[model samples]
Target: MPGGGAGARRRGRPRKDEPALTERVVLDAGVRLLARDGLDAVTMRGLAAELGVRAASLYRYVRNKDELLDALADEQFAGIDLTRYVQDDWRAALTAMATALRRHLLARRDAARLIAGRFTTGPHSLRNIEALLTVLRGAGLSDHDAAFAAYTCVTSLFGFVAAEQNRLSAEVAAGMAPREYLDRLAGRLRAMPADRYPNVVALAGELTAPDLAARFDFAMARLLAGIDALVAAGEPR
Candidate 1:
């Protein structure tokens, strides 16, 4: 009789011995799905299946797909290390922070797209912004200028990563190596009439270089230089 009761219990609805699903668990599953299959595949139904739960169960943790994505972005932001970038020299600190952000974004597929247009007030995101503001203010920027600096840095990061990802995807789709693609582009640029586009023709090699790192570094330097000039002029603060 005791054996029969144990068997009945097993045959009956399985006990929920596993821990209850939390927002973290749902977001983790969503991130894995996003990384493996891209953003289109990271749906509530898909995530539920990944977690061996029903789609409706996900609603208990997140209201909808948008919220789920926000949770995912928050998780990604939580991983960024701003400690090394929070130093006396704001220029160095900002550079480090931007570099770190770009590196982290590129680590996951479609990650740049995920966080690009969305505004997140999550703790981690807020913390990162606070760190940036602190660094800029320390460098003699007023509150308004510091906020603007932080915004500029983040917008540049998102745009750069988004463009980089798109270019990589295009290269893969076209089945062309990065250098080969750039060479082809250079050739096209050189074909333009030298009289009409002399500068473009002359700078084709530099313009079409495949060195993304150099391009990013140059852009960052220019941005910081503009800020330094403004600071020197005692414009805002």
Candidate 2:
């Protein structure tokens, strides 16, 4: 029984009690969707539905899904406590940062894949890069070397996390626990012909150990050793 013009106007207007939508709100909704349904579920339309708003409304905040993902990556970087590295030795600082990044990405589903290889110029990401550069420069690396080192460290961290996630997914799809799978894999390695693969057969247990933490630590130590050697060799700026 409502009049067409007046009713349409009333419906179009936001109520005083309604909360105003902001960029943060849109990003937050996107985060929740990413967490619950993985990165593939995050889209302008999906986020709008979650927020109970029109998809066009989200464009005011983020131009597209790629921008929204950059924001989410920025959000992840913001959680890292860079202050804790203020007094840390250069190696310790890098290790802490890498460890924190890996843990953060692993905590969210598809988080590593979401942020990996995406160049984000957002505030949080810039801050993290600056911190890394500072750490490398503090360790006596020249300006150019520090920049390259920082880039290497960040890319390595992202790459490692992406690979780790893939391994986890494969394990899940195979319907076998990680340890069980590793044990079976080790057994197969041990069965290989000694003449053709002596070293692999001889170290099957070490190669297929289920201790991801230990393996990660070992690899990180090796990477740091190489960096330290480069710093010692004083590679030209």
Candidate 3:
């Protein structure tokens, strides 16, 4: 438990000449690189530079770009404690897992895109997916539905975070507020005739709250609710 999470890998500072071979060290270093630079910036050469190891040594932990992406995904998802959900009531458990997964993915900013679908092939990723599937299967989902539900939940999270990241800008990062940004946007929307775009005019205020977390939660809840309804209707998992 001590050597876990982001700080876990760095429980003690690395000695000047020592580099850690532990998977946690390797994954954390990679994540730090991706967070600082975008996904494209995380080449073997770049990762080696961060870990202070020869590029080839990375193979012990990850094989290629695909493997590297998997590792990244595993690191992000490592926070999930599946055992808690395993004992929860079926539908409630799945929804809870969805919310937790979305929050974890969104917290990492652009990191979600790096891991969404690569889990099946990566060791750590496969383990994470298996954990989720195990929980779902116990709750009464067929393997097929469990897999599909997993896909839907993951994609929903990725899309939500990606959209939120796109809307962020350097100026906004510094001091520009969303309210100021939306005020200007509202002015532009006002210039259009209400009669021409009745729904847009009436719901002008609704579009302004681009609350990434709230919107993601609302959408995820609805999607899971639909999934539950479908299941009850005898729809395939």
Write down the lDDT of every candidate, Cα atoms only. 0.78, 0.75, 0.67
Q: Which 10 consecutive positions of candidate 1 have the poorest summed lDDT?
A: 1-10
The digit string of per-residue lDDT tens for model 3 on 113-179 reads 7765554444445565676777666656677887887777667766777666654556566778867
**Stretches of model 1 off by over 4 angstroms after superposition:** 1-20, 168-171, 193-200
Candidate 2 ranges beyond 4 A from true positions = 1-20, 167-171, 191-203
lDDT per residue (tens digit) for residues 1-237 in model 2: 011133222323323444567657777888899888877889888987888877765555666666778888777776776656644488898888788878978877777788778778777777877777778888888788777777788777777777777655466567878778878888989999999999999999998766777877887898798789878988776
Compare the candidates by lDDT and give the number of the best one.
1
Q: Which structure among the candidates has the greatest TM-score?
A: 1
Candidate 2: TM-score? 0.81
The better candidate by TM-score, 2 or 3, is 2
lDDT per residue (tens digit) for residues 155-211 in model 1: 888888888887554765678887788888889899999999999999999988888
TM-score of 3: 0.73
Per-residue lDDT, model 1, residue 170, is 72
What is candidate 2's local distance difference test score? 0.75
